[model samples]
Target: MTEVRKGRTAKRAASRAVKRRALAIAADGALILYFLFALFPVVWMVILSLKPANELFSTYFSFTPTLDSYRTVLGAGEDEGVPFVRFFVNSLVVSLGAVGLSLVIGLPAAYAAARWRFRGSENLMFTLLSFRFAPELTVIIPLFVLYQQLGLFDTYVGMIWVLQLVTLPLIVWIMRSYFADLSPELEQAALLDGYTRKQAFFRVALPLVKPGIAAVSLLAFIFAWNNFVFPLILTSSEAQTVTVGALSFLGGDRPKYNLTAAAALVSVIPPLLLALTIQRYLVRGLSFGAVKS
Candidate 1:
């Protein structure tokens, strides 16, 4: 009777193990399907960009691939009419400029808001946060007229200044949280060691939050880089970024889908490369102060 019971138990355990393996395989397959579904549009864009102009509308996967679209966008090939290089460079300058200005202005502001307790300080911080939730369209018309009257139309200064609306609040709010998460005891210890308040901030607090700065700066840059409304309305030619410049490929009598696809894919490279390069800092920054232990 004992021998028979042991044999039955072993057989049941083997059957249960096989079922668990099958379930694991099914779950993995489902996750893979979801990933592919999410990635399909990007994959399609790459494929379309690689296809020659003649094969752009081809239904099947047998189309010939060429570098003509990329060449044209980069100003090295047959199509020289559109200066994509200028547009791309403009984006880099404008995005970096906006983020730089935001850091300069927002960092001190965030630290103050974090450390001080002035009357109406909460109201002031809330007011700054409110700017982000307000839609850009509501104020663009007034801003448009204002920029025109002030001689700031279609200029780098105008675009970078205006993007402060997008980047500033984000930096201030996130950095405020980072500063708050830090224990005041650290700065106090520095103070006891003969460091002035300013010195404490620069030598102690600032160094500690470097990862957070890296993470938030990248976020701000991505937002500023992808901004459409400000650049679309404010810039006509000289300072137009890739967000608007990509549309130029479709401007003529007939839209060139291949060129448009090529422009977009090329435009994605810089931001993608930046995110990949600083991914470690970004991860650390994001996870900063998430757990006490």
Candidate 2:
């Protein structure tokens, strides 16, 4: 009787183990499929970028690859390749400047909104957030007029200022949540220990939210970098970002799809590198305050 029971128990354990392995395999298969789905566009973009102009419209996957497309887009292969390098630099400058200014202004604003209650503070924060909800087209014409009058049109300063509409609210809202998740007692303790309010913020409160800062700054930078409508309408050449400049290839007689693809892949490098550099902090920042003890 005892031997029979032991054999039955062993069979049941083996069955459960087989089921668990099958489930794990199914989950991994699903993940791999999703990853491929997400990566297909990028793969296709790369393939498009590699194909020579003649091969661009070919339906078949097999192709002779060449670097001419990349060289042309970089201004080395063509005499007048639309100044893509300049546009790339403009994107970097404008995006960085926007993020920098947002950090300077939004950090304090977020901390203030998180830590204190003042008259109209809610209204003020809501008003700032409302900028995100409204479509940019609604205000672009007025802004165009204003930029023309103020002589901010096609200037780096103008692009950065306009991008505050994209960057500032994100920083303020996300960092405000970070600040709120923090215990005020930490800052209060710093104050009691002879730290000024400003010092407490810089030393105690700020360091605690470093992960959030890194994450939000990356997001703000990407938003600023990808913005197209503002740059397209506001700037002609001097400060046109890659988003607008990439379209320049489409201007000449035949649309240079190969050059456009190469330009796009090149433009993706900065934000991709930035994300990889700070990926650790990004995960922590996103997960922070998601759960409570």
Candidate 3:
């Protein structure tokens, strides 16, 4: 009886081990497939950007890579037709402006929502979310009319204000959650030690959650930087963003595929660089409130 029991136990353990190994292998395969799906478009973009104009639609998959497209897009060519640098500067300005405005508005709102048990706080937060989720087109026409009437049409300030809608709710919601997860005890202790509420927040709470703040700022910056529609209809040449500028490659006569790809590559660089630089903060910020002491 003992010998039979031992044999059965060994068989069950072996079966369980095999099952675990199979599950792990399946998971790894799925991840690889997902990674490929996500990366293929980026690879294709790089290939198209590098290919010379003549080879753009060639049947052969192979082509000699050249810097002509990049040079043209970067305004390194003799003609300097494309105002890539100007568009880049405009995007940077708008992105920074949006981030500054959102943080200014969102931080206090988030702090109040987290710390105060005010009447209808939940409703207010939900209302903010509703605005956030609403389609941009729905508001665009009204905004356009209003801006035009108010003499804000085709202005940088108008575009920045419009982008605030994109960045504000995200900042408020994320910061509020982070603040809520943080213990009030820390603030209270600081207060007891003679620090004012504002001082306590700035000195104690803010410093500790610097990672979350950095993450939120980075996210806000990226959203504003990449926004296409607002800049598309809101402003013309004077305040055009990289997204709109990139579209210039597609004219009425013909599509400049190589130039478009090059423009796209140029548009992608700043945000990608920012993301890479602040990736650590992003991870830390996202993981905030995920664990408990």
The best candidate in terms of lDDT? 2
Clashing pairs in 2: none
lDDT of 3 at 48: 82
Q: Candidate 1 lDDT, tens digit per residue, 25-97?
A: 9999999999999999988888878888777665547787888888888875226467788999999999999
How far does residue 45 in candidate 1 sit from its true spot (Å)? 0.9
> What is the lDDT, from 0 to 100, of the residue 249 in candidate 3?
75
Q: Write candidate 3's Cα lDDT for 1-293 as tens digits.
A: 99999999999999999999999999999999999999988788888888887888883458999889988887652254568778888999989898898988898788888899767878888899777799899999989889889988777888888998999998888888888888999999999999999998889888877788888898888888888888888887888899888878777566777887788888877888887988888788878854211
lDDT agreement with native, every candidate? 0.88, 0.91, 0.84
Q: In model 2, where do residues sit more than 4 Å from their true spots?
A: 1-30, 290-293
Better of 1 and 3 by lDDT: 1
Q: Which scores greater on lDDT, model 2 or model 3?
A: 2
Would you list the clashing residue pairs of candidate 1? Answer: none
Candidate 3: misplaced stretches above 4 Å?
1-27, 76-81, 290-293
